[model samples]
Target chain A: MKAPCTVALDRTPLYDLHIASGAKMVPFAGYHMPVQFAAGVLKEHLHTRRQAGLFDVSHMGQLRLIGVNAAAALEALVPGDIQGLVPGAMRYTQFTGPSGGILDDLIVTKAQDHLYLVVNADRKAADLAHLRANLPRDIAVEPMEDRALIALQGPAAARVLERHAGGAAGLKFMSSAAMPVMGFACIVSRCGYTGEDGFEISVAGQDAPALAAALLDEAEVAPIGLGARDSLRLEAGLCLYGHDIDTTTSPVEAGLAWSIGKRRRAEGGFPGDAVIRRQIAQGVTRRRVGLRPDGRAPAREGTPIADKDGRNAGAVTSGGFAPTLGAPISMGYVRAELASIDTPLDLMVRGKAMAARVAAMPFTPARYHRG
Target chain B: MSETKFTEDHEWIRVDGDIATIGITDYAQEQLGDIVFVELPQTGDTIDQGGDVAIVESVKAASDIHAPVSGTVETVNDALVDEPGKANEDPEGDGWFFTVTLSDPAELDDLMDADTYKAFVAKL
Candidate 1:
């Protein structure tokens, strides 16, 4: 097993609370974040599906793109329909490199005056640098270091949050509002990484612990760690940055073409637009697909995949035992010809070929509250 | 008379005459968190000392169970295949992975006693 790098680890605002809650802290993206709590990963994952699970996501980068032309300026960097976003509306987009590879995927929410953005923890510094370098000086990139984010996710998330912030319950999915939560003004976005009806609340760093404690006090809420967070997203078939989608993968190949608005596709204004447009017009050679291994033995990341004739097809990028499905699940890039649903494939595990098939994602259906 | 011995790798062995029952220590199960699956050695398979005998997969990762001494597989606890969590619940008892006929009884002398193993774990 690879040893965990523990040098110069950073702590989030809720670090003390996590320690008090018996969290198994591990080095994740340079932060000492909780991997699992006393209840373990399995129980926490189930609780999030049934009730509510509170996750401290302060490690993610939160920033504001200030200026009137912020949306148009950002559109030049990503394929998402940024300028089309109305106030309180959010769009998920990726920062594409000059070669059409994804620099990072982020959530861009149009606030009243500026565009609020949340990026991956590991890519925060690089994203900040990219935004600073690419975006014109007229658009100011303000990194919000004094804020902390908490995600209250699950079927009962809205109910648990409704008690604290009444206005938050009214926000539709992918919408955001500055609501008073626990006596502090917070940006409550009706969205979450988990495929459930949930909210991600951005609050002052100092008030984070208190706010998290208040929410955890609810009967339907439990403090969750990163372990459950991974399984929940995997079951949801969400792409994990640096794993399922990375610098070598294109948005079209990764099955994220829906995020590229129609206007952006026709207008052709973004880094690597030529390559992306070509790939969009014609299909990609390799495509991302979901794999359901036939047995209990999980075909983990980097597991080689073979075709029916025992020829090398592709490799698994992200995989593990899905607690919800009670079977091993995986997501990997395969030859375009074999990316069709129900395509029988073989996952090579420790020199043995395990039976697996390409299945439609998300291994579980998303339960987002559309209204 | 039967005597229990422990290896540095956290496996437990109970020797009765020439037959020895092998399983993981409670400490090993606790470290692995939840066991989702178990891959045990087949009956009649010959395993050398310290060879891979079984595999215990937790929600996090998989760990190999090595033989404490060279022996031929006699019987395995097939119950673990259906309920791998049994290893977490009763690691040293019903969680036994398999039993093997001892090929070298002298290898038992190198194993640590229960008290000595407990002291070894404490230092970790």
Candidate 2:
């Protein structure tokens, strides 16, 4: 049977570059992105770990919230302590709905007199609407459509970036500052989805091609696609917006309560703060946990997890054959009572139940540079 | 020497006497990136001409390998279970999927030759 054809939504500045590099493009989150290149997913993933990999994350939504008290206005909607964030620092936070459910997870970085934010491409429209409806009239949520975002990730990522943007070597994790990349003004942050020591560079769309080319010129760097990106993040135990965490799942149950600042939790002003605070105080009915399947058969998404007595415990949210682990691994939400490290569980794969266990998050230890 | 034939479905069969070795084409492996697992029928299993006899799962998607010709499965490549990347590394050589004893040798004539398969892939 022929596979369904994907309609191109929008092309990044590096669209032609991707094709020239032998990338296999696919439609994802309303944009045409490279799924894999000639190197294959496993090789691309391993290469990223051993060195730096360039990812075209221009499909993600980039916005600049400009106002006198922009942080205060944003703090009203999100649970993170945005007001206390020092200039040139970033924080990972979530947009909360009126019902206390999460709208989307995003990155908020304090820039020069403005707040720079990056949101998921699939939920950009919804995120903007939510921000406008709740934010006061004084604040302006301007979408930076002319900017393209790229991620340079891995242990050697800093070396590659510093070669262009001098002084970036001093930036710590979750920090951002204006830097000249390939002679273009860019906001470089020490952050990324791969859980590696990396930087997310936001540059002008027109300059993206040159900057991408400059990074690729380095002998240590190669173009990574969405296929490898997903596997890398999965191994890092990072939550994907739509798959792992969604509007229906609360941040507490998703094991992201640490993202909520202590001051914000005490003040209790953000949307869904009451419900979330209660979940934190009492406890959630279920919690997200990682699983390691006993065999090579991958426990794919939607696979039902059962307890020892054949009781439905949970369902696999994301699962695959982890190349690093050399076996199948999965992540899913399970009953709170059974959410413990080394807890034995069973995954139903193709009618045969396979043994599994509830392991701690980050199947692979995150290599983010805190220094 | 007998000629090898290719199917539009991407399966290739090299017939030598009564035995034929079947595997996927290079174009097919490229389309299915990073093969992670393979499921093959055991020896002695019967399959129709167009019936599915094997399966291959990649990180991106899963695909069914249909039998190119009606035959009884004579052998399977057991080495593929632990090293599925062999299909990606050498799809036509070491990655040969399974061997079958052809039930009808005449069915081979209906398949495309290497030249025709090259043209078919070029159109895609």
Candidate 3:
């Protein structure tokens, strides 16, 4: 159709650079982002898996929680073991509602001085308000609006980063450190949404273009867009907030129990901890699972799922053509009894019953740098 | 070297007497991105001039292919069903959607020629 724009969208620091590189820009989460470049979505997706792909993730909200009790304050809101998080280590967790539903998915890193947090762009305003209202008046949630986030992901990402920032490759998975990226002071983390081993670099917004250009200059790196990011994360079995998970879905139901630390599950202090604990013990009616459609027809979001008798079972949340799998893969909530692997099901596409099966998640194996 | 008529909706039709071949324009394929699957109408089915006919599903979205003129469907491109990317590769040639027996050859006169269609797309 027409280019994806409906309202006044924001631009990232690399916006003009993307256009100069022939990227097809579109509206995404209130920002005008490149969905594909001249190489197209399919090509960009595969290149990221095989080598490396540079992505502009500056739209995400970066915040610094400054207080004497930052981790303790955040632990009251999230289920993750923030108190146990060592400085320079990041933990993935969701901000939950009083009823235990997910407010948003975020990554919180225990920086040297204060706690660093990166939240989804769409939920930043509300996330900030929620934090401010919940935490004591002493804790200040400072927004880093002047910062830009870029991800260099794939198998060769480490070597490329090693060339520019020699200290980046030394960090382990989910680890962060302040290093010089392309001669600019940046917080480089060995983490990314993609299943590939990579790093997410946070730097001053003005220095983003130089950092992005330096990464693009690497032989293994190519500038990618959001289109490939979605597919790559889908194959990684990662949940997309407001889609795969939301205020209606809980952590246990969404299969994110691991994110809730063992001590937090027992302590029972965070918001909605009671409801989540009950779901974990008694189990949930519906659970998120991976689905493999029988044919080439992709069962997109909102596609209905049916049982053997053609009775309505559930609906697809995130579905698309997974480039790595070479076929269509989807993740959605289904009846708990039917959430097990190899459970035969049907995805109703265009009034026809397309045979499907509940398969193991992370449709593509993760290549995270564990060391 | 050729004569093909186009509709404002972006379909391109090549007529040979009463039998006509229908497909989307190059511009249409470019906008649709990579075609993953296609649903074509059944053979022998009758369609109105402006009725919604087949469907083309790209990686991004699914778009309905409207009938350019009243006709009876004769055959579909099965090759496209197996390899949908062919539509992106050669949208004007081997990517033809279907063949139809025209109910009225006069409807073809109302369509825009190659040169007129090119200028019309420039306005968009």
Top DockQ hit? 2
User: Tens digit of lDDT per residue, candidate 2, span A103-148?
Assistant: 8999999987899999999999999998888889989999999999
Show how many residue pairs clash in every candidate, following the order shown.
0, 1, 0
lDDT string for model 1 (A265-368, tens) is 99979998999999999989999999998888988899999999999999999888788887889999999999999999999998899999999998999998
Candidates in descending lDDT order = 1, 3, 2
lDDT of 3 at A149: 97
Candidate 2 docking classification: medium
Candidate 3 CAPRI category: medium
| Winner of 1 and 3 under lDDT | 1
Instruction: Write one digit per residue (lDDT tens) for candidate 1, span B79-99.
Output: 998889899989999999999
The candidate maximizing TM-score is 1
TM values, all candidates: 0.98, 0.94, 0.97
In model 1, the number of clashes is 0
RMSD of 1: 1.2
As for lDDT, the candidate ahead, 1 or 2, is 1
For all candidates listed, what's the TM-score of chain B alone?
0.98, 0.97, 0.96
| Model 2 clashing residue pairs (backbone) | A100-A272
